[model samples]
Target: MLKSTFLSVACCLFIGHHAFTQCIAGGSNAVAPYASNSSNKGVMFDITATNTVTISCFDANLPALSVGGYEVYFKTGTYVGFETNAASWTLLGSEGSLLSIGLNLATPISVPVNKTILAGQTYAFYITASNPILSTGVLTTTNSGYSAITSNSDLTVYGGAGITYPFGTVTANRAFNGTVHYILGDPLPVEFLDFTAVKVDQSVLLEWETESEHHSDYFEVERSLNGIDWNRLLTVKGAGESSVKEIYQKMDDNPLDGISYYRLNQYDFDGTKTSLKTISFNNKVEIGENDIRIFPNPIIDRFRVFGNQSELETLKVFNSVGEDISGSLTMTCHEGFTDVVFKDQVEGVFILKSKTNSQILIKK
Candidate 1:
């Protein structure tokens, strides 16, 4: 959810002939107290084992910045260098609803790296935001790596911070702070897309589609009041081994009153499971449902919300399509009012908002 300081040394790995869990480097993983003053950042490393590595989860360290969120991307190979943006890179999903700086290495950020790196291949990754995060208009991966530092026999971490997708010019080898958590196995056989949860009347409807799958057994639908604790609601049969798109759905007939978090996990025939992605849905508005509203019903650029300081702080907005687009919107707060703006502007779209105490606002 946040971050920590990291120690720069060599790559260390824990291995098993079949499957074992290990991290990217050997040193203690955390954030650096200072910034390298670089552009976008990521990690570059090489795995030597014949067995592939599955990137489970990873965390980043921003020495002195609190960000709205981070848009993360990953690519295979040992990082070619100098990137402008993530136009060409593959998406590993996003991390941190609001990635802030702190000291928490025990928890891996939720930028689900459900990707598998081929045997004896290299890999690269980076995290970025719409705006600079460091105090000096920079975002850091922290300083916790070195050039050709072999942490063990199975893996070799190359160089310090690997600069990625620079907005301005370029800066390389700034030491990638934080560590990448990997599993000693191949990627999941099945691939999925568009996992969504929507409030359908009094219950919640969960739906997801798969592009391809092989040796897959079934999918587990789990729900949580908070994102931490999860309970398995039901299991749906998988496509087994299909090449076309497969659709699946589940119903949470007893969802929480306000916000409910839903997570999707797929299990293989051999019982190997991979956690896909987590999304949230607002069941209903409990209070202030009629009084809550946004100005300029059909906003062109921006809108205003009149509320106290506390109400403004807890405000969250979703699109008509039901995605948690809160992090995509910007906020400017005054004493008794707050200005809201969506960066990716579009016309004729509606917005759904949820504020403190289940207050709801719907605007076209």
Candidate 2:
């Protein structure tokens, strides 16, 4: 047995035969009585079915004046005819011919079909009343199941062309360091969001949380040395819904000597893609003349400095804005290496300047 469904007709009004509005279910519009010219009005029906169905239009006015002079078409194809039930379709209200009728009346009509439908098939019904002069009236119509054993199906109605239905899902899992680190889901369209990054020991960690998603397909993590030409580092999926959260993370083990920029490329399921806001990082780890080393370079918590010499003197750390963070000379440059530790400082870019009289170390 097929599923039960209902289709209700809504009335709409047009004035002066100039402007047009949508004709929804359970709506009505008032128009002034006309004498000669008949105006054109219509309602479109979108149906998704698996078997043939019947469409009927009815109003308060019947027999005296019937709905005959109108055009009907299917959005996906063409309408064959009104079928055998067309004549039996009922109408109510007093009516008369165009030459004799002076009072305003309502008319209704119906069209039935017996064609077979397939699963997931979509079809549309359009009814239009066209006349050269002024013909102002109301049209009411309904669609009902004619075949007894029709397949159980559903029909999604749309207002106009190019409208898309929201039918997607997304899921995320895995959390680390008090934050979610993994995500996967359907592709969504384009939108806006925020991303953040942090430096942990020798590895730079990236994390981004999403509040909502739409037609978003996936995201590509990109990295750049000079904030210019970027290369993709990783790809993350999107959640195609609202009121959901998605988290993504990636680690860049090898940071540049100066600064690095990162961005995300959000792609849609339809091949449409856009880039997110770019973030820059000023890495103070540099290779010097005596040895390649990194000091408390703006080291908020703790950091270690390394060099290729066995002798050392003083280690000075300054913030990226040239503010002195710490100055220390307690270093035993053994095997050309030493680690300086600074505790409880703000996280930001900094410069480490080290000197051994005969050898000087500078990192920005």
Candidate 3:
């Protein structure tokens, strides 16, 4: 009787171990609107650890009788180009021998192990067919429940080819791409619900709220005068770990004379840090100068001049005393953003002249 009991327990342990090792693939149940059109598009996710990152499972939609592998890469910028070029890339991992595929089937193909990644830097990962001869599976796409931080990374894609036609950054409302499952980095500790900055008299007030916190240590408030040079202002305690909403606020008693930038950094108990988005505030400034949107209002040498491309022809800047400053105005337009760059400009208020309108632009 004793021997039989011991054998039964051993058999149960073996079965459990075998089941855990198998990879289960997943994808959208029905046809979705998004599809992986080409190799120049992928999802961008930040590596949460410094030691090593592992891609647990890879899922894809393949054609019938497909047999090939994928080459995974880590890139800095868009899906392709100098940033995605071989000179500036880190080969994370690769896998082969993915065989016996069916028509339009979404399944977990392979699991590659340890690839080194930085702790706090942003990275984009893409998968390409190992060989061009065989049919390959692309990351099937979808777009639901994509608002929060989930297993899905932000979907970024590129459309152009070669050195001349650059694949500009275009964020689409689609996810459910390759490798939906990850056993690599730790989960994001805090989910920010809302973050806003308001100017109250001489001081600026910074406020933010989080939906949940896990193993969170504290919040470090950083201030910047030019949005480039940052300085630590204060630290506020977090909820440690909670599922309820938590509200936090900090006052910048010594806001700069003009415009200032504020950003939040959340730290975990184990020294893991994540940066929240940045916001700007102006102490004594106009909300919208003459019904024109002049952001970072108290400009720090650089600001954008937004206007409908067809409606506006030329953008010029003049000093506070109505003198056109001696400098070059470079304007670049892409993806509906027109940035007016200024060179050799001094601090103070100015006027931005467009074809049909003029706005007061303050420089700090």
On TM-score, the leading prediction is: 1
RMSD from true fold, candidate 1: 14.7
Instruction: Specify the highest-lDDT model's number.
Output: 1
How many backbone clashes are present in model 1? 12
Stretches off by above 4 angstroms in model 2 are 1-191, 285-364
Cα lDDT tens digits, model 1, 1-364, are: 1111111111111110101111233222222223334534343333333446666565555434355445455556655452533333544444334445553222335555555666787776655543344323224434444455334444445544444323333455555445556666665677654465544445655667675898999999887887789999889999899987676867777877766677788899999987777776666533233234344333435665543233434555655466666666666543233556643555334445434333333232
lDDT of 3: 0.48
Model 2 Cα lDDT, one tens digit per residue, 243-346:
55456667778766566777767787787865554566656633344443333222333444444332223445565467655533222222223434444444
Instruction: Arrange candidates by TM-score, descending.
Output: 1, 3, 2
1-364 per-residue lDDT for model 3 (tens digits): 1111111110000000001112323321222223544322333332333322333345555545766665454455433334323324433334445563544455554533223234443445555555446533344344433232232232222221211111124334334333344433534677554345554444555666675798999999887888789999989999999987677868777877666677678899999987764555655554332223343344544554433443334455777677765245545543323445553466555777755567666554
Give all TM-scores, in the order shown: 0.55, 0.27, 0.33
Instruction: Tell me the alpha-carbon RMSD of every candidate.
Output: 14.7, 30.5, 24.5
